[model samples]
Target: MVTGPAPTAARRSVEEVRERVAAVPDPELPVIGLGDLGVVRSVATGADGVIEVEITPTYLGCPGMAAITSAVRDVLTACGHPDGRVRQVLSPPWTTDRITPEGRRTLLAHGIAPPVSPAPDGPVAVEVGGVPCPHCGSRATRPHSPFGPSRCQSMLWCTACREPFPHLTAL
Candidate 1:
């Protein structure tokens, strides 16, 4: 656990910093915050305001990587760690399991289904649940494209809604 400047002086605790970072929505998927999207891996701070965060991209070439970095920096800066550095940790890679329980709720609320539990940490085949139609809330959805809006998502059309939605592909 890294400690930052006193909460009275800095107006934010490490947990608060994390909460702020988690609250910043992903620029690409406005419906999901970075935390909800499982982009923020960790947050820590030193005694003298030396803050650092670890994050990994959902996909190798995901366009939102830069945006997530910027959001992390912006939130820390606003919270009094203007010089903080955000590090990208890609070794183990990111998995849907990192998605917080609240994040899963957010995904479901946004009409995007949550991924299966205990997902693998790297690119590996995992079973994905059928996406419910955002319009009609039906499970009769089929993949339109293995690769959809992004590498992590599959383009699917709901037989009930007859509309395309992004479903998190199997791990």
Candidate 2:
């Protein structure tokens, strides 16, 4: 809770509000914005003049949701939309495929191999040999562990570079 003088309300369009909210960074993965991460489902203004931001969680029990929600609320309040509220929309659950191309590039640049997008009707196919290594861009990476710091990621070790990195798993 930010405790300061209340910001003056400004008349911003829905798109403006959406852009401001979408620009918020993912708390866990600061390299990607919520929009690029595909968590920001929608932003709109209600008839009551309250701003509504809808987001989908990457996983059902993602630990970062609280932080994300807090960040959204803070941003809204700072921008003068004190009535703004965040809504968690779980329908049509989030999948790795929702990650934007820019998000993938950002992850790779940050030494995390982005998950291969899954098929429209199915989950991602398991890599037969190994997944690509973000460090060396080699396909000689093996899974160090199926579990990672987060539910949507796995630890991988690159044989080519002998480096360990996280891979965003396809949901």
Candidate 3:
């Protein structure tokens, strides 16, 4: 891996740390980077040169949060920022709306149905609606189960394609 310059007497810049942390992929969704998923909330470097990365989990009990934290630390350390800290902030809960447009396209390309954008007013239930199938791009898709392999996803079956896929739950 290409490493950045070691931190000098002064702390490294936030943008420098963010650039490296942004490249770290989500443990559950490898196709999407933490930045693209809008999970890496902020990156800051202290006067002592320690970097802190704040992230928000997609769900309250998301199992991947631990892995994502470790991955962020590992990436920062590899990039010459050792002893990096990963903080999980729960104040502003994460929402599917945070996922970027490019991330949504990447999810669809990876055969995972991206979550539909929630109403701007507030959160909405992800009921059986007009969620298009990722594989066939058909609107004839139905929810097979409320739960999926992961807490943030739901099992969906495409009627036209006769295939089952995981749909990211909109929160």
Best by the TM-score measure: 2
Residue 114 of model 1 has an lDDT of: 66
lDDT of 2 by residue, 1-171 (tens): 769975587756778878887889987788889999999999988888788999999988889999999999887877778788899999999988888999999999998899886557876677666778988888988889998866778899999889999998887
Expressed as tens digits, the lDDT of each residue in 52-166 for candidate 1 is 8888888788888888888888888788777888999987988777777887777667766666675347675554546666667787888788876666777788887688877
> lDDT of all the models against the reference?
0.77, 0.87, 0.84
All candidates in order of lDDT, best leading? 2, 3, 1
For 79-123, candidate 3 gives per-residue lDDT tens digits of: 566677889999799988889899999999999999778667887
Pairs that collide, model 2: none
Best by lDDT: 2
Query: How many clashing pairs in candidate 2?
Result: 0
User: What TM-score does each of the candidates earn?
Assistant: 0.77, 0.87, 0.81
Winner on TM-score between 1 and 2 is: 2
lDDT of 2: 0.87
